[model samples]
Target chain A: MMEEHKVIVELKQIATRFGDNIVHEKLDLKILEGERVALVGGSGTGKSVLLSEIAMLREPDSGEIELFGEPITQMSGRELLAQRQKIGMMFQQGALFSSLTVLENIMLPIREHQHISGSLLKDLAMLKLRLTGLPEHAAHLYPQSLSGGMLKRAAVSRALALDPPLLLLDEPTAGLDPAGAAAFDDMLLELHAALNLTLILVTHDLDSIWTVTNQVAFLGERRVLMKQPIEKMVKDTHPVIEAYFANERAKRAIRQELI
Target chain B: MNEEKQPPVISESSDGVQLRGEWTTPYLKQLQKISKNNTRHQVNHIAIAQLDPNGSRVLLELIGNEPSAWPEGLTKEQRGLLELVREKVGPVPAQQESVNLLAALGQQVFRVIRHGRELLEFAGQLSALVFSLIRHPRQLKIKMLLDVLQRDGLNAVPIIALLAFLLGAVIAFQGGLQLATYGANIFVVELISLIMLRELAPLICAIIVAGRSGSAFAAQLATMQMNQEVLALKSLGQDPFAWLVLPKLLGLMIVMPLLTVLSMLTGIGGGMFVAMVQLDLSPVEFIQRFGAVVDPIHFWVGLIKAPVFALIIVNVGCMQGLLAKGGAEAVGHRTTRSVVQSIFLVIIVDALFSILFAQLGW
Candidate 1:
């Protein structure tokens, strides 16, 4: 089933630089449709930067990126809009527009791309809010008033507003409590199953990487060191990958999994 | 697929009206148009050719958000999506129109009162911090104060000088016209010196500082507050006002008087130039007349207002910053309020000062 799936996002020979510092060099990644992939690395590994590059929020210094088979670097802004509509990105800080209520934030992207009646738009936005497990009252509240977990959910709802085929999350469960994080992971799984969404998440949480994702893309040396199931990748003896999973947090997650 | 153009169709079927084809967000308008003609509220059987979240939502809307009427032929995903929309979708609360005049007035009054209370509270706290710091002057952050002084004071010199010069020139040209007519051309010297020194110079300088440094302080502090740096300071057992507000207040207070003096000199120079050109008064004669008639007390009065204006501007800015809630938008809003409130208070205080000066025979 995985072999038959089409590539949703493709990056080849990507490079990112900030002045004299090279963040990424010759980085390559391919995300297939319906696959739950986690981009995991230590801080400064540029996971968020890589996620943004794939989301088309930021352009890599040098790379060829294709979304849904079309090379985005060569695509016109109009063409890119069509491709961009198929991808949704949630930032680490829950970058929901603080000025807008949660429901309005969800409605904005759909309203921009699709001409639906105001009632239908509201219903759709509400459905998105529900799908993310946010309370109905949360729909009317501004992003500022939301708790950390609710804010993340609101951000996810906004990301899912257009029902994008590909969902990208940057640390979706980072600030959430253990139960909230677990519930969020479950919601992601359910959404992925129901919507047939190709999920690419940048996460530091080992539990999220273990439970929410099917494949782990370990980023090290400014590139993906290995890409495989978490079960297999964890066992791999690659020194950088070993060093990453050797942390106390990773051990706790692994221990929990065994039980 | 060419199926993209095939909008959802409603057909009369044995299971009641069957809504078929893609009912996604993009095709919603077309679906609504067709459904409206067909009385889509009767759509009970959802024969899904394709369905997404938006499609499911539109389907629910067509069925009046009643999942009980939904047919059993749907797949688990389709059924789940449809039920999800039906179960969770709530009535969009009507946007509250702020049309009631009395309510609006009441709200405005409450806002002003609340603002005043917060300002008083902040002022009290600030004074307490000042008194405590005064007792331990060695604990003051001199480096931060000097940094703010350089930024808010020295960096503003060129713009202040240019504006003050132009202000003086305009005053001299306007006043010199009437003076020249009445054969009191030399009186332009007194007019320019008195207005520039006693009223316009300090007022204009305060307004400029309010626009520039006042807004900057509000924005910087608001961002810090939003980013939890203010809380972090408190967590570290440091008063945010001592760290953030004091340096700014001291800097502005030190700067405003010096800037006003600069403005006064430039204003007088501008008036001299205008007197030379417009009133046929030479620079030497104008200076001599300025020396003879321009009361030094007017200059003192203007200089005395600077620190007061500075205090009001900095307090308003810091208060707005600390009071800022929400995110980036609140920072912008607070900064605007800082500048506007600073200018308004400065003007009101200036007017009060004018009355006080007049009554005191200053």
Candidate 2:
């Protein structure tokens, strides 16, 4: 995928505090269109909060969020939603609508975001499901019946249903077996290749960072520790990043656990 | 220190890794079991200690390979649970043979009532939560209602119908047997009519709705609570009550009455079928007698109770769901509480109605 210099989302001096507990402070990042950046950190380091704020799921008390060259912090409810539609997000737990069949899950983005008819939405949903290596029959079946991997794939399919320019995945490979995680990685790569999606993945899964993502960002201590190529990230000398990479458990188990 | 020196030489079965790892060999079985049990026990102790930190004096290592392995929010809570485990277990030895089941049951019953009191109070306070959410309708609220009601309320219809059918059958069979003995088979019509229209119809329907939808409501809100979606909505200048609670309350308020009528109609239909075929009554006479005997006032009374039952079901369901703490287990627990409380409240409301209507010369 060709990297676009166009900054689709930019966070400048972002800070979020939950009462006395300050999650992130003065976090800064520029996500270029068609850039695949994996945000990695400790659990309490506010990776999800960073992603949520950018996604307009949360608003920082201070700092600015610009999506598609528009100031997101200034955008109202209707406008934020309009921006959300253009950006696809795969929730940490797959977050497939439990009420919906896999087909319906995919169709939801279409139903909410566009003017497509139900049948056409179904066809589009099936097509997206296929791209994730899921069969069309998986479409009609509800989420509870699905295996963890199948549910993630269905969510991925749904995320792509609206043909979003930017796709944000929160721990895309978590709760999956190795084969499932690997398969998910392949599916992500395939989607990136096929759609040229500007991907922002918030994950602590180092394996995913190394194997799947192109760029990596580390968030911690109220700031972005680093944002650069994955290769450069692993080679960086930051103590927190070093401690993370040095942890033996991370090498063997943390990838699967964190995903 | 020699025991801890090997870093707990626990090894996974290389082959068993492909499956859920139940594979065992006789030679190494004891070692595996020892390590596995020890690991689980240690984990439990640590988690329990986190829930109730004073339970264990020995500090366990905070043993996550990475930050993601453990819940960040649960450390303090885990300490509290551990400390309470000692409190919960009491000083009584487990080997005691003369343990009183009733006493145990009584303690559980007492705790439940105590818990239930706070819950009912919370149910009353839900309108305040609703009022705060009215100014803004956030996505989280939208998602919660849409998921809970659609996933639970709509999907649970078949099971509710089945339960109503079975309740009707049981009543018809028992009523038929008693009436047969008295040589008053015709009076079974009046009995069935009275019990079902006035009491069983609403009671059974309320129970079914609570069991099915109440639990779902608790789980959905609980998960949202866990994720801070409720907080997120508030931060985004949206009010969760109007967005989430009001619509669901409205939807359930609408759906429950229709369901009550369905239950009443279905129960009667089931009874009528058994009456005609099993008891050898002519269909025309059964219909005419059923029509003649049923008071229009009973129908109104049944309709009237539906909203009250709805209030119980929706209120308890949503209330308990919102009250969910911790993870999936808390959700399940809350769901159970919601259903039980919903059913209890429904019956109590029904009884109050009965008392009031009786005193008013109904």
Candidate 3:
């Protein structure tokens, strides 16, 4: 799979900082096409910051980021916008616009990028909603009306509105019951397969790590400590990686994976 | 870093253009010049080697959509580098057009009209809510109504009374000084009573409510908005206007008239004190003179404007609050806006009422 797949995202020497707090320093990563990558880190490791940078919502303090073989730093404003349109981002809080209905939220990006009429836009938005497995009645309701699980699914529907090849999720299953989290992971896998999307998610859920992602990028000490298959990552001897998977829950998850 | 060792070279051939070396921001001007000069020819090929993100962007700009083939003799690493460049470099920037001042002015006017339309629409919604409650009294939230009345009206009495009393004392003092020169100090009762009852009492009370209750209304709604409670209400299929805004509006309207009557009496009492201490007038004499000069028409005229001012204050405050968005900063902004707009509109409506009454020969 690695040999046949194309490189979709490349980060060379990325450095991110807020005032005196440096989150990432000289961080390098490469994400292959159609791969499911999970970024795991302790608090303040800048996993979300890295995800935002990849989404092109924020520029890294320093370093080069290339998307689909093109360097993003040198692209013109219009080019940058075009590149961003090809990538979908789902925020941690499911940042659906409060003023818009769920269907309208999905239609927003589609309408912004296309010159289609209102009816067709609504149809497309409804189709995306259906793809996310939301009930037909959920389309007319505002985001605040939905349950947390439904809200996340609505956000995912909106992210997939334009059918972008790349999808970035920040803490996709941060707040959920175990059953809901497992279901969300399954939905993610289903969506990835159905859309042929390259998914990069930031999460701290050990179960999510084992279930959803093929590769795990452990972030610590202001950089990605390792990027490898989750199986290889489980056996990694690095101190930070060792500490992370040393917990009883992690051990159980690893045992389950091995079984 | 490897590209830094070998500088990029741009050469034009019969078939196409070939770019080699580290293409970056520093060499952008040279690339621009080359592209500008070669615009006349149909460049069919763009070959890129050892290019960075910036270099790739410049090359993409230079090549436009005319490139027919990739760079020849490129290694796999170089091919990856070229692909990265191609991905980074997007379509050329659209030409900048000059701004038209008339069109800009037209847009500003259109925005103002839209704002006015929205305000009118909000007023209509509040009116509908009020009518709906009147028709179905059972639907009214009596508890919320009483709560707002307690908060906005009952709590406001002491401050409003004190302010009105002070205002009346100052008017009497000022009028007494002028009347003393003419040896017509006895007429000071008429002057204080007329001004207090006809204009000052209701106007002062309205302004106080606008500042106190109006600002409170805005801040309360804004906090609810920030907390997503307003959104929660909408999600629950509850009418925010009826549940939140109507009660405040009705409460203020009911309270304003009561507050006005209190203001009038206190203002007269204040004038009596000033008249007794400074003008050598007894309380009995002042009351006798006041009873003769002050008419019901003057009190009614002032009291009639209270509900209108109440409507303006509550509407402006609630409208501003509902418009609040974002976080704490936005709540603060809408609260401030509510007070300012409520006060401004209250004064404007007060002036219009004065004009209307004066025209009617009142």
Candidate 4:
């Protein structure tokens, strides 16, 4: 099955450490084309760090990362940038440039990579904004003026500006109300289907894990403890996985069929 | 795919235009140019061998949905790509509004006035907090006060000493060169002493502190503000001014005069060292000459400006920090603003002191 599908990202024998504190050791994961994958872990389990590694924003201490079948280390600077343009990563806090309006923020990556005219670029950016479910007027407003939900959606619009094959989201539903999170999850599903994007999100939200992702990769003890479909992974006997899935809130979410 | 060499080709036919070659992001400029001339012309065929998502969107945007036409022998993959593009790229309503320069300028002026008013209000509140703290002495956090003093003052000494010493040496060396031509080498002591005591020492120390502690204060407070710790304090019913700003104010004020005195001594010592080496004057001779020519009034004049300079540095730093909003970038902006404002205000205050002292004939 893995051989049948094209692998978009492959991390092999990845090791990351800061001084004496090892975050990841000999970790390996492969994400196929158009897969919706979630990275879940405890507070210090380096889920976000792993996400950064996949995004090429950070380099592993020792390992190799291949994006679209091209080894990242082997690619020239221009080729590497071209590869990076195929992947869009949103930071935990939206990370929109505060100086630019929502429209300008979304247009930034597009303008950087594409040579379209200003008016057409604006139109393309507007299309992205509309796709993310943001109102037309939101394009004029700065990130600071937007609510938490709008900001996240705006960030999604910016990430989608280049129409990347892979989208990495760091805690997409964090700090959102349940309804807002659910709405965001629905938007993600719509975007995933429409754009044919491969998604890798690092999230602690149990509801998000169930609602958004098909596959969950649990990071613990300096490696991926399990990578399986969410349904099957919930029943896994791994100590950390068991504890995570057996949590009170997890149980509640499961009982409500919200996950 | 040698994208630069493969500039997208537009073939004009009797029916319509057929776009060939790779239609990717790099070729969007060429596509836009082609579209500009043929805006009225219908795109009857898209025979491009490759089309990325961005390229597909551009192509669909160029070819508006009309009485339909498709490329002959179009592959299923190409059709799928076109379909995706049609689904995503809808008619984009153009933004027509132009910027009004005069209105923008007016808004900027209003923003500046509002900022000035806010700064004045902050100063008033700070004064009130200080007055209340004086009345309720037990409310002051002595531990935090001491920590700030040690951090902002004692830790500043090494840098201050080095800068002051170097500046003094430069002044002495420069003065000695001019003085030596006139056989007035001894007067270099008077020049160095008077300048170091009355102006250079205090000015340099204040500027250094502004660069060091002022920027640090702004960055610290801005980060706290960004993290909502300041809001947390407000929610907890604790005045952040009393806990944070007042200690910085007090710590800086207390240390500035002391640092100024130390700066003066170090500067004079440096001048003496330079004079001994360059002018062939003994250390004893330099000291004696300095003591004789430099009056107590000059030292007092410089010392009197220290607390005022300190107040300016602390207030500007704290004000910038308090005004900071948003993220790490906001903190950096506030820090830069704090240093610039503190240095500007310190120089202005120093000039005012100079004028006042001259009027009083000090």
Per-residue lDDT for A47-93 in model 2, tens only?
Answer: 88888887778889998888888897677888777677777788988
Estimate the Cα RMSD of every predicted model relative to the unseen true structure: 3.3, 22.5, 11.5, 4.5
Ranking by lDDT: 1, 4, 3, 2
Q: Scored by Cα lDDT, where does model 2 land?
A: 0.68
Evaluate all candidate structures by whole-model CA lDDT and list the values in order. 0.86, 0.68, 0.81, 0.85
lDDT of 3 by residue, B1-362 (tens): 11234455656676566655545333444545554566555444444444433344445545553333543555555455445434332222233455599988998999879877877888999888888888988767789999989998999999999999999999999999999899998998999999999889998998899889988899999999889999899999998887899889889989999999999999989999999998988999999987887778998999998998899888888988888876566778888888887778778888898899899988
Q: What local lDDT score does residue A6 receive in model 2, on the 0 to 100 scale? A: 79
Over B241-319, each residue of candidate 2 has an lDDT whose tens digit, in order, gives 5555666676676677777778787887777777776677665777799888787888778778987787777787777
Once fitted onto the true fold, the runs of candidate 4 whose alpha carbons sit more than 4 angstroms away are A1-30, A41-46, A57-79, A217-229, A232-240, A247-259, B1-30, B33-41, B45-53, B67-120, B179-186, B234-237, B273-294
> What TM-score applies to chain A of candidate 1?
0.95
DockQ, Cα level, model 1: 0.55
Taking the tens digit of each residue's C-alpha lDDT, what string does model 1 give over A1-259? 6444788788899999989889999999888888999999889999999999999989999989988888988888798887788788899999888778998999999889888778777877888898898888887898889999999989999998888889999999998899999999999998898787889999988889989999999899989888899888877899888888777447767678999
Each model's number of backbone clashes? 0, 21, 9, 0
lDDT of 3 at B207: 87
Model 1 lDDT at residue B299: 94
